[model samples]
Every structure is written in structure tokens, then in C-alpha cells.
Target chain A: AQTVTQSQPEMSVQEAETVTLSCTYDTSENNYYLFWYKQPPSRQMILVIRQEAYKQQNATENRFSVNFQKAAKSFSLKISDSQLGDTAMYFCAFMSGTSYGKLTFGQGTILTVHP
Target chain B: EPEVTQTPSHQVTQMGQEVILRCVPISNHLYFYWYRQILGQKVEFLVSFYNNEISEKSEIFDDQFSVERPDGSNFTLKIRSTKLEDSAMYFCASSADRGRATEAFFGQGTRLTVV
Candidate 1:
């Protein structure tokens, strides 16, 4: 069994600032995938960024990047130059390489970007 | 970009009634999945379907729940007898393959309100 944890239940960031959301997971599988998803008020779940466990380098997508420490079982999402549109519920997810499309998600963090 | 489509953005049903959520995955996707998120909770995996059959499911997916790919493009999740606890936002996702690098795209969730 695998579990993803987001310790922060709520977070706030000033507009144009940077914010980091923490995530940790417990998985026995050596090869797996980590993802961050954003759900806005519309309830649309959008993929923010993804990191492969085998890749030592972190994943970056425009303003969204990740700090993945495989040894520590930590994968945190960093949003740079955050904007009001970045306000949403963020979730950390895990999927085993061999588990097909089964994704286990964390409790999610409610992020507010204040102007 | 190709996107997964789900019908009836919101559904309200009485307890003990049957409810069906429908989805149309990406044209090239080979894997389909169903997940649910109770209000203010983590997104939980329900089932994954491949080749018209379920490949994986979670403990939350009990006998009352069933998944089907009745047609070439549509994937469906049915709750035979819904309970109040079953009220949640149901999401449909699809992926091209079962690889560590591939990512799953989620649809705009359908909010199921069981009263």
C-alpha cells in the first residue's frame, strides 16, 4: 500500500511572490511517479507538474517546479511568481510504475493567492 | 490539446437510488480510471479500466460500484445503491500508457450529491 501526505491544510501567498507546498509519500516500490494537481473553484483538476522517481533532476513547468528528494520520499511543489489565478486546492499524487493508471492522492492543501 | 469529457457536471439523487457517471476519454488513450473526492478530503481511486475490463480497484470500490466501457469511446461508473456517504466529486481520467513517465489527464469532475 502507498500513501501520499500533504501536511499543510491551508496556505497563503502574496501576489507575485513564491510559494512552496510540501508533500511526502510512503511507498515500497522503487520505481514510481509523483504528480501535483490543481483544482480550481470550477472543480477542474489540472496537472501542474510531474516527477519521475528515477530522475534525479527535478521537474519544472514554466512557473511550477518541484523539489523531489527520492531518498527522503519527499516531492514538494514550488510555484514561482505566483498569481491570483494560482489560488486553488493542490494535491500530491503517487502512482506505481506497474500499477497502471491507479493514482493515490494526498489530502490536498487549500492555497490562496492574496493580492 | 485532447481532453477527457464527463457528462452532467452535477447530479443529485436520493439514497438507495442508482447513479451512473459517464466519461469520454481522449481518442488515443488506452487506460481509463475513476476517482472520487469527498468534500474537503483527498481524492481517492475507485477503479481503473483497460481493454474493456477493470485492471485495478481500491477498497472503497465495493460490490455496489461497477465500471464499464459499453462503447468504443465512452467509459462509465455506476453506483448500484448510493448512500449518503457516496456523495462526492467523481473524476474521470485517461492515459496513453502504463509507464512511469506518462501522465493521466483528468476531466472536469461530476459532483454527485446523494441525499
Candidate 2:
């Protein structure tokens, strides 16, 4: 069984600054994918960024990027030029390449972007 | 962009009553899934459906929980006898395929409240 862990229960960042949410997972599989999802007050879960475990280069999507360290089993999400809209509960997820796309998510971290 | 749609954004029901949550996945998607998140807990996988049958399921998906693709467009999750612990936000997601890189698109969750 794969388990994702988000150590930080809560985090805050000033507007226009940057914030990084840490995530770690335990999986024996060599091929997998990691993702960061944002859940706003509306209860809509949105994809922030994703990283393939086989890729050495990190994945970047506009202001959202991931620091993926496969050896350390760590995949952290970084949000640059953070805005108030970034405030939400962020969850880290893991999906094995052979598991047929089933996702295992972390407990989540409450992030607040203060103006 | 294609998106998944769920009906009855919010549902309130008495304990022991039956509740059905409905979702319409993307037109071209081939995989469907159901997940639930308690108010302060991680998003837990319930079941995954493919080819009109269940391909995978978690421990949380007990005998009380059942899924059906009754028609061409609708995917439904039914809780035969709801309990207080069953109150949570239920999410419906779909992926284009079971390939290694496909992303699952999620719908705005349906909040279920069992009192």
C-alpha cells in the first residue's frame, strides 16, 4: 500500500511571495506519478501540478512547480507569486503506473495566502 | 475543456436511509472512480469502475456501498444504509485511459450529510 504524507498541517504565505508545501510518500513501485491538488472553499478539487517519477527534471506549470526527489520519496509543491486565490487545502497524491489510475492522497495542508 | 458533473451538490439524509450520488463523466473518458473525504481527513478511494464493472475497490467500500453505470452517461454510487460516519464530500472522477500518463479530471464534490 502507498501512503502520502503532508507533514505541515497549516501554512501561510504573504501575497506575491512564494510558498512550498512538503510531501513524502512510501511506495516500492519504481514507476508512479505524484500530484498536488487544491481544494477551495467551493469544495472543488483542482489539479495544480504533476510529476512523473521517472523524469529527473521537475515539472513546472506557470506559477506552480514540483520538486520531485524520487530517491528520497519526496514530492513538494511550490507556488510562486502567490495570490489570495491560492489559499486552500492542498493535498499530495500518488498513483502507481500499474494501479489503473487509482490515487492515494495525503491528509492535506491548509494554506492561507495573506494580503 | 471537458469536465465531470455531479448532481445534488448537497444531500442531507437520516441515518439508516439510502442515498444515491450521481455523476456524469467526460464523454471520451473510459475510467470512472468514486472517492470520499471526511471534513478533516484525507481523500479516500472508494471504488473504480471500468467496462461497466468494478476493477478496484478499497476497504472503505463495504457491502453497503455499490456503484452502477445504469446508462450511457450516468455513474451512480449508492449507500444502502447510511451511517453518520458516511457523511462526507463525495467526488467523482474520470480518466481518458489506464495509461501511465493520463490525468483524472474531478467534479465539484457532492456533500453528503447523514444525521
Candidate 3:
């Protein structure tokens, strides 16, 4: 079994500033994928960024990036130049090698961007 | 960009009643999935459908729950007997391929309220 943990339940960031959401996972599988998803007020879950366990380099998508430390079993999401639209509930997810799109998600962190 | 669409943004049902949630996946997608998030809880995977059959499902997807791809574009989740615990936001997702090979596009969730 795999488990993802988001220690922060709530986070706030000033507009144009940067914010980092922490995530950790316990998985015995060596080959896996990590993902960050955002759920806005509309209740739509959107993919923010993704990182492969084999890739030592972190994944970056525009303002969203991840600090993936495979050895530490940590994959944190960093949002730069945060905007009001970034306010959402963020989830950290894990996909084991054997499963087809079976994602294990964390408790999620509610992020608020203040102007 | 192509997107996954779900029907009936909200659904209200009585206990022991049967309810079906609908979704229309992207035209080119090869995989479809159903997930649910209880208010303030982590998102949980329910089932994955591919090639007109279920490829994978979580333990939460018990015999009481069923999934179907009735048409070329429609995927549905049926609950034989709805319970108060079944009340949550159900999301439909589709991906171009299986496993971690591709990212998934999620539809706006359907809020199920069981009373």
C-alpha cells in the first residue's frame, strides 16, 4: 500500500509572492509517478505538475514547480508569482508502477492567495 | 483543448435509492476513471474503465458499485443502493493512455447529496 501525506492543511500567500506546499509519501515501489492537482472553487480538479521517480530533476510548468526528493520520499509543490486565481485546494498524488491510473492522494491543502 | 465532461453538476437522492453518475470522456482517450472526494477529505479512486471493461478498481468500489461504458463516448458509475456515506463529489477523468504514461483530464465534479 502507498500513502501520500500533506502536512499543511491550510496555507496563504500574498499576490505575486511564492508559496510552497509540502508533501511526503511512503511507497515501496521504485518506479512511480508523483503529481500535484489543483481544485478551484468550480470543483474541477486540474493537473498542476508531475514528476517521475526516476527523474532526478524537478518538474516545472510555468509558475508551478516541484521539489522531488526521491531519497527522502518527498515531493513538494512550489507556486511562484502566485495570483488570486491560484487560490484552491491542492492535492498530492502518487501512482504506483503496477496500477493503471490508480492514484493515491493526500488529504489536500487549502491555499489562499491574498492580494 | 479536449476535455472530460460530466452531467448533472449536483444530485440529491434518498437512502437506499439507486443513482447513476454520467461522464463523457475525450474522443481520443483510451482510459476513463471515477474518483470521489468527501467534503474535507482526500480524493479516493473508485474505478477505471478501459476497452468497455473495468481495468482496475479500489477496495472502495464494492459490489454495490458498478461502472459502464454504455456508448462510444459515455462512461457511467452506478450505485445500487445509495447511503449517506456515499454523499460526496464524484469526478470523471480520462487519459490518452494507461498508467503513468500520460496525464489525465478531469471534469467538473458532480456533488451527490444522499439524505
Candidate 4:
């Protein structure tokens, strides 16, 4: 069984500043996928970014980038130039490459971006 | 820019009653899934459906829970007997392929309140 952990329960960042959310997972599978998802008050789950375990290079999507350390079983998200719209609950998820695409998610971290 | 869409943003049902959550996945997607998040808890995988049958399911998906692709475009999760603990946000997701091969798009969740 794979388990994703997000140690930070709550985070705050000033608008235009950068913030990093930490995530770690325990998985025996060598081939897997890691993802970060955002959920606003409307309860919509939006994909932030994803990283393949085999990729040495991190994944970056505009202001959202990931630091994936396969050896350490760590995958963190860095939000650069954070805006008020970035305030949301963030979840870290794990998925085995060979399975039916079921995702194991961590307890979400609620983020607040203030002006 | 295709996305998954779920119906009835909120549902309120009495204990022992039945509730059905519906989703319309992306037209081209081949894999579908259902997940739930209890308030203040991690998101948990419920079931995954492919080729018109359930490909995988978690232990949490007991006999009381069922999934169906009754038509060409609609996927549904049915709870035979709702319990207070069943109150949570249910999410529907879909992808073109497996976890390592593609990204899964999620729909806005349905909040189920069991009374």
C-alpha cells in the first residue's frame, strides 16, 4: 500500500511571495506517479502538476513546480509569485504505474494567500 | 480543455436511504474512478472502472456501494444504504490511460450530507 503524507496542515503566504509545501510518501513500487491537486472552496479538484518517478528532472507548470526526490521519497510543490487565487487546500497523491490508476492522497494542507 | 463534470453539487439524504452520484467524464477517456474525502481527512480511493466493469476497488467499497456505466456517457456511484459516515465529498475522475501514461481530470465534487 502507498501512503502520501503532507506534514503541514496549514500554510500562509503573502501575495507575490513564494511558498513551498512539503510531501513525502512510502511506496514499494519502483514505477509510480506523483501529483499535486488543488481544491478551492467550491470543492473542485484541479490538477496542479505531476512528476514521474523515473524522471530525474522536476516538473514545472508556469508558477507551479515540483521538487521530486525519488530516493528520499519526497515530492514537494513550490508556488512562485503566489496570488490570492492560489489560496486553496492542496493534496499530494501517489499512484502505482501498473495499477488501475487509483490515487492515494495525503491529508490536505490549507493555504491562505493574503494581500 | 475537456473536463469531467458531476451532477448535484450537494445532496442531502436520510440514513438508510439510497443516494446516487453521477458523473460525465471526458468523451475520450477510457478509465474512470470514484474517490471520497471526509471533512478534515485525506482523500480515499473508492473504485475504478474500465471496459464497463470495475477494474479495482478499495476495501471501503463494500457491498453497499456500487458503480455503473449504465449508458454511453454517464458513470454513477450508488450507495444502497447511506450512513452518517457516508457524508463526504465524492469526486469523479477520468483519464485516457493508466496512471503512468496520462493525467486524470477530476470533476467538481458532490457534497453528500447524510442525516
Candidate 5:
């Protein structure tokens, strides 16, 4: 069983600033995938960033990037030049490469971007 | 751009009543998944389907819960007898394949309110 944990319950960042959301997971499998998802007030789950376990290079999507530490089992998401639209609930998810595409998600972190 | 779509953005139903949530995944995708979040809490994996059968399911998915693909495009989740705890936002997702850690696209969730 894989378990993902997001210790931060809430986070806030000023507009045009940066914020990093923490995430960690406990898994026995060596091959897996990590992801960060954002859910705004509209209630749609949007993909933020994703990192493959085997890839040491972190994944970046425009303003969203990730710091994936495989040995430490830490995958954190960093949002640069945060905008008001970035205000949402962020979740960390884990998926084993050997199994079906079953994603185990952490308790979400509520992020607010203020001006 | 193809997207996974779910119907009935919100539904209210009485306890002990059956509720069917419908979703249409991307036409080219082969893997389907169901997840739920309880009132802004963690998103929990419910079940994963492939090749017209269930590949894996979480412990949270009990005997009362069942999934089926009645047609080529429609995937459905059926809850035989809903409980108050069943109230949550249900998400439908799809991926191109399994084992590669491919990204899964999620649909706008359907909020299910059990009274």
C-alpha cells in the first residue's frame, strides 16, 4: 500500500511571488510516478506538474515545477509568478508503474494567492 | 484536444437509493479510473478498469460499489445503497495506457449529496 502525505494544511502566496507545497510518500516500489493537481473554486481537477521516478530531472510546466527526491521520497511543487488563478487546493498523488493507473492522493493543501 | 467528461455536475439523492454516475472518457484512451474526495479532504482511489474488467480497487470500494462500461463510450459507477458518508465529489479519469506512468486526465467532478 502506498500512502501520500501533505503535512501543510494551508498555504498562501502573494501575487507575482513563489510558493512551494510539500509532499512525501511511503512506498515500497522503486518504479512509480508523482504528480501535483490543482482544484480551483470551479471544482475541476487540473494537472499542475508530474515527475517520473526514474527521471532525476524535475518536471516543469511554464510556472509550475517539481523537486522530486527519490531516495527521500519527497516530491514538492513550486509555483513561480503565482497569480490569483493559482489560488486553489493542491494535492500530491502517487502511482505505481507496475499496477493499473490507480492514483493515491494526499490530504490536499489549500493554497491562496493574494494581491 | 480530447477530454474526459462527466454528467450531472451535482446530484442529490436519499439514503438507500441507487445513484449512477456517468462518464465518457477520451475516445482513444484505454484505462479508466474513479476517485472521490470527501468535502475537500484527500482524494481516494475507488477503482480502475481496463479491457472491460476491473484491474484494481481500493479498500474504500466495497461490495455496494460497482463499475461497468455498458457501451463503447459510457463508463458508469453504481452505488447500490448510499450512506451519509458517501457524500463527496466523484472524479472520472482516463489514461492512454498502463505501466508507463502516463498522465491521466480528470473530468470535472460530480458532487454527490446523500441525505
Candidate 6:
């Protein structure tokens, strides 16, 4: 079974600054996918970024990027030029490469972007 | 962009009552899934459906829970008897394919409250 861990329960970042949320996972499967999801107070879960385990390069989407270290089993999310809209609960997820696309998620970190 | 849509943004039910959460996945998606997140907790996988049958399920999906694709476009998660612990935000998700490279798009989620 795969397990995702987000050590930080709460985080805060000043507006226009950068923030990094840490994530780690334990999975025996060699082929897998890592994802970062954001849930605002509105309760919508949105995909932030995703990284393929086989890819050496990290994934970047707008101001969101991931530092995917396959060897260390670490996938961290970085938000640059953070804005107030970036305040949300962030979750890290793991999925195997098989036919079943079920995701294993971390406890989540509540982020607050202060103005 | 195509996205998944879920009905009954919020549902309140009594204990032992039956409830069904509905979702309309992307038109081209081949894989569908149900996940739940208790307040202030991680998102947990419930079940995954493919080809109108359950392809995978987690321990949390017990006999009380079942999933069905009753029609061409609608996917449903049914809880035979709701419990207080069943109170959570249920999210429906779909992926274009079954590969790890493909990302799953999630719905806004339906908040279920069992009283």
C-alpha cells in the first residue's frame, strides 16, 4: 500500500513571496504518478501540478511547480509569486501506473497567504 | 476544458438512511473514481469504476458502499446505510486514460452530512 505524508499541518506565506510545501510517500511500485491538489475554502479540489516518476525533470504549471525526487520518494510543491488566491489546503497524492487510477493522498497542509 | 461535475453540492441525511451521490464525468473519460475527505483529513479513495464495473476499491468501501454507472454519462456512489462517520465531502474524478501520465480531473465535491 502506498502512503503519502505531509508533515506540515499549517503554513503561511506573505503575498508575492514564494512558498514550498513538503511531501513524501512510500510505494513499492516503480512506476507511479505524483500530484499536488489545492482545496480552497469553497471546497473545490483543483489540480495544481503533477509529476511522472520516470521523468527526471520537474513539472511546472504557471506559478506552481513540483520538485520530484524519485530516489528520495519526495515530491514537494513550490508556489512562486504567491497571491491571496493561493491560500488553500494543499494535498499530495500518489497513484500507481496500473489500470486502477485510485489515488492515495496525504493529510494535507492548510496554507494562508497574508497580504 | 472538460471537467467532472457532481450533483447535490450538499446533502444532509439521518443515520441508517440511504444516499446516492451522482457525478457526470468528462465525455471522453474512460476511468471514473470516488473519493472522500473527512473534515480536516486526507482525501481517501473509495472506489474506482471502469467498463461499468468496479475495478478497484479501498478498505473504506465496505458492504455498505456500492458504485454504479446506471446510465451513459452518470456515475453514482450509493451508501446503503449512512453513519455519522460517513459525513464527508465526496469527490468524483475521471481520467482520459488508465496510464500514469494521464491526470484525473476532479469535481467540486458533494458534502454529505449524516445526522
Best by TM-score: 3
lDDT of 2 by residue, A8-67 (tens): 999999999999999999999999989899989776688888888889999999999989
- Residues A1-115 of candidate 3 have per-residue lDDT tens digits of 9999999999999999999999999999999999999989886788899898888999999999999999899999999999999999999999987898888899999999999
Clash number for every model? 0, 0, 0, 0, 0, 0
lDDT of 4 by residue, B4-98 (tens): 99998999999999999999999999999999989888899999999999999999999999999989799999999999999999999999997
Clashes of 4: 0
Kindly report which residue stretches of model 4 are placed more than 4 angstroms away from their true locations once superposed: none
Candidate 2 lDDT over B12-77, as tens digits, reads 999999999999999989999999999988899999999999999999999999999998799999
Across B1-115, the per-residue lDDT of candidate 5 in tens digits comes to: 7889999899999999999999999999999999998985788899999999999998999999999999989999999999999999999999898767688889998999999
Error of 4 at A59 (Å): 1.3
Per-residue alpha-carbon lDDT of model 5 for A1-115, expressed as tens digits? 8999999999999999999999999999988999898989776687788888999999999999998999999999999999999999998999898878888999999999999
Prediction 1 global C-alpha lDDT = 0.93
Question: Local error of candidate 4 at A114, Å?
Answer: 1.0
lDDT of 4 by residue, A31-112 (tens): 9999999989785788899998888999999999999989899999999999999999999999898889989999989999
User: Candidates 3 and 6: which is better by lDDT?
Assistant: 3
iRMS of every model, one decimal?
A: 1.3, 1.3, 1.3, 1.4, 1.3, 1.5
Share of reference contacts found in each model: 0.77, 0.58, 0.79, 0.79, 0.77, 0.77
Between the candidate structures 1 and 3, which one is better when assessed by TM-score? 3
Candidate 3 C-alpha error for residue A68, in Å: 0.9
User: Which ranges in model 5 have alpha carbons more than 4 Å from their true place?
Assistant: none
Write one digit per residue (lDDT tens) for candidate 6, span A1-115: 8899999999999999999999999999998999898989875678888888888999999999989888899999999999999999999989898748888999999999999
Worst 10 residues of 2 chain B by lDDT: B96-105
Which digits, one per residue and each the tens of the lDDT, describe model 6 over residues B60-87?
Answer: 9999999998887999999999999999
What lDDT score is found at residue B40 in candidate 1?
83
Better of 3 and 6 by DockQ: 3
Better of 1 and 6 by TM-score: 1
Candidate 3 residue-wise lDDT at B82: 98
Specify the poorest-scoring 10-residue window by lDDT in model 1 chain B. B97-106
